[model samples]
Target: MTASPNRGLALTVGAILAIWGILGFFFAGEGGHAFFGNEGGYLWGVFLVNPALCLVWTLLAAAMLIGGLGTTIGSRNLNLLAGVVLLVLALYGLLFMNTSANVFALNAVDNGFNAIVGFVLLLTALAADRENLRALRADRDDLDALRAEAAHG
Candidate 1:
């Protein structure tokens, strides 16, 4: 049988989250040694940039995206939070990173792409909740109509 629209929507969001998370794991591991230029808490690679922060943001985004799974039950907050974290991570890469002679240009590319996707995830999460909200409104309207009828009777 065909899946309901809401379930389809949730599955799509979940898939995106999972894919992004997997990509992030690879990005974080390689980033510390390739970009930041260092090996520990600090970066020793390109322009002494810190890839550690990227790891943190990526994890946070992962968490947020995972939270989107619960959006069906009015848990869009996680998705929203993920969007914010991704945006913030993008900004960090944009503002602090020295793109002049970066090793992996793909890192920069992923950062930019993730920024756009973060917002999209948030939008999709909201859209998925729309049907549930409509149902609630309908229920409220029916209750009001019943009350009115009772008053007349």
Candidate 2:
């Protein structure tokens, strides 16, 4: 299949997230914070991170990479799923950032990043895959028509 926007975004974002997650581990608990607490140190003095958050990002990166390496529909669907999940996480982080409930050690920057990336993923998946879907359906219909014609002939 042709390279779609969703596929490209998924691969690119997944790679970046994977790298960040991996590197974040080296700095996790730098100040002796809890594994899941919000008091973890900053990554590159920007993004707040912890072991749990790194694990989450690694898992998310896996999903994104799997989707990106699969079919177009798979990429789009995974992007949508990831988008929704990230948006929810963003909201949760915003609400519990400074509380004990901040299990992912999220901060304002993380929440904002999640929200923006989530929105972009959602928008790209929803609005950019129409042509691909239509083309796929057309191909399937053509294949079916050809099979029927062969059987009848």
Candidate 3:
């Protein structure tokens, strides 16, 4: 009930890495499991694909996602950790999944998602790289006082 955005995003990243890792754990017999009709299998039951690394990635993402949510809901720094993880994973996805033609179109879609997530995380990390938060050279109160003084004083 009312989960934070970081928590939601963490779940998403966790799910992606976890599912992919678990799926990798399952050995596919070439020809794409015969059920879907492709010719791709997870291969080596995920051992060769660096299952451990995927797990690490998931754990990092979990922290960062939660942290990011903390930042969003609490303070700006709450999600810095999560943002880092997102950036790393985005790069990882781009490096590992982007060029792969093994999984048909799935890899492409995943890579696209990875790019989006990474970019968003980068923005969050950079605080949108905002030039300023103030509306003008002076504060609102100052502007209001000026206006009031000009009008009555």
Please report, as a residue range, the 10-residue window in candidate 3 with the lowest summed lDDT. Answer: 128-137
Q: How would the candidate models be sorted by TM-score, starting from the highest?
A: 2, 1, 3
Work out the TM-score per prediction.
0.50, 0.90, 0.39
Summarize candidate 3's per-residue lDDT along 25-65 as a digit string, tens digits: 35433343432222335433322233333445456555554
Off by over 4 Å in 2: 145-153
The TM-score obtained by model 2 is: 0.90
- Sort by lDDT, best first: 2, 1, 3
The number of the candidate with the highest lDDT is 2
Q: Per model, state how many residue pairs clash.
A: 7, 0, 5
**Per-residue lDDT of model 1, residues 1-153, tens digit only:** 112333344345556545544444454465345443323222223212234444554465455444444434434555555556667666765664455433323245546755886676567556666767677679889999999999999
RMSD of each: 7.1, 2.0, 10.9
lDDT of candidate 2 over 96-117, digit per residue (tens):
9989899889999989988998
User: All models: lDDT?
Assistant: 0.51, 0.89, 0.46
What's the CA error at residue 126 for candidate 3, in Å?
5.2
Worst 10 residues of 1 by lDDT: 40-49
